[model samples]
Target: MQINQLTRVYRYDGIDLPIPPHLADDPQGLRAYHATLYPAILNAETVDAGVIGTTHVTEYRRAVGTKG
Candidate 1:
């Protein structure tokens, strides 16, 4: 769960659709959906690259990095 990224499980005629990155390329639709569904799981995704022994996980939708 992450900020900006909303998790939506949509049911239409008993069919479930997954809308994970709602605000990425479609913010308007995401907003509209948010207004209606009022999502249950909402969280902000963050990454920590300052740690000494580790790996950093970041959303490409928000941050960019390169590794060699």
Candidate 2:
């Protein structure tokens, strides 16, 4: 999603993260409720065809008392 859109959504969720316009224009930008060690992954079958890119995986640390 675009940064403006993300900002709007975050506002609804009570989050106020400030994102720059340049990063929003980048092809590989994302926001998540959980902190990430890596980035997001996009599959060709899931996205528009003819687009080549790298998939970054995010690993969130489970909260205390949570069982994996």
Highest lDDT among the candidates is held by which one?
Answer: 1
What are the per-residue Cα lDDT tens digits for candidate 1 across 1-68?
Answer: 64343333333323333455746457456535543553321222222223233322222122235645
Return the lDDT, model 2, position 26: 40
The predictions' CA RMSDs to the true structure, in order, are: 16.1, 12.4
lDDT of every model, 2 decimals: 0.36, 0.29
Residue 56 displacement (Å), model 2? 26
Q: Looking at model 1, report the run of 10 residues with the lowest lDDT sum.
A: 54-63
lDDT of 1 at 12: 30
**Cα error, candidate 1, residue 21 (Å):** 7.7
Query: Which regions of candidate 2 deviate over 4 angstroms?
Result: 1-13, 26-28, 32-65
